[model samples]
Target: MFAAIIAAGVCSCYYDSEEGLYPSISSTCDTTNVTYSGKVVPIFANNCLSCHSNARAASSGGSVALENFADVSAQAASISAAINQTGPLSPMPKNGSKLKACLITTFDIWVRNGKPNN
Candidate 1:
């Protein structure tokens, strides 16, 4: 899936394997203590805002605003479901792999940890 996302040109490479790279996204929290403020916001800011936020007038799912922690936290259940979408439906940001596996892992952890504010 990661390969396909990259191949489809949905996300750009922030660092190369040859560069002994840094993670594509940055967050204050790690896998052990994921939280909305520290871990999840950065992912959405970099990946999802192109379409999901007010900055873009062409995006869907406008019923919810994803600009900040408070807005996102209010939509916690929706965030969880999107992150874990199945079948034909893709997760948030529609199609983008800029977010590394570690980032997604942190999101999973945040959901598992009850979507804390941090």
Candidate 2:
């Protein structure tokens, strides 16, 4: 009985991987190679498209369409401010949670990179 109890406790007491317990450590944000098509569009697609797509911009995105590169580049300043929740304007993803730190970094980097078509 003592041996069984010891074995059970030992088996159950293993440490969880860092990635599982604290994602930030292992899930470092990839900031080295952010690109407009490779990184920016996908973020918008996942987080902003429901309201910010071209088709719904007038009614849902407050006329802020992000479905294409030109539109996003035109709105770059506003996008940066909104995503960081820094300006007097309401934060973007409107009522949603702030984007992940990595995602924000990625967008900011892309903007700094001139919102390139690449």
RMSD of each: 11.1, 11.4
Q: Which ten residues in a row have the lowest lDDT in candidate 2?
A: 17-26
lDDT of 1 by residue, 1-118 (tens): 9889886663345333312233443454256556677668888877777676755624564545687677677776776567656434457556644346577667766765676777
Q: CA lDDT of 5 in candidate 1?
A: 83
Which stretches in model 2 have alpha-carbon errors above 4 Å?
1-27
Query: Number of clashes in model 2?
Result: 0
User: Model 1, residue 82: displacement in angstroms?
Assistant: 2.3
Candidate 1 overall lDDT versus native: 0.62
* lDDT, model 1, position 85: 61
* TM-score for each candidate, following the candidate numbering: 0.54, 0.75
For candidate 2, the TM-score is 0.75
Please list the residue runs of candidate 1 whose C-alpha ends up more than 4 Å from where it truly belongs after superposition: 1-29, 57-61, 87-90
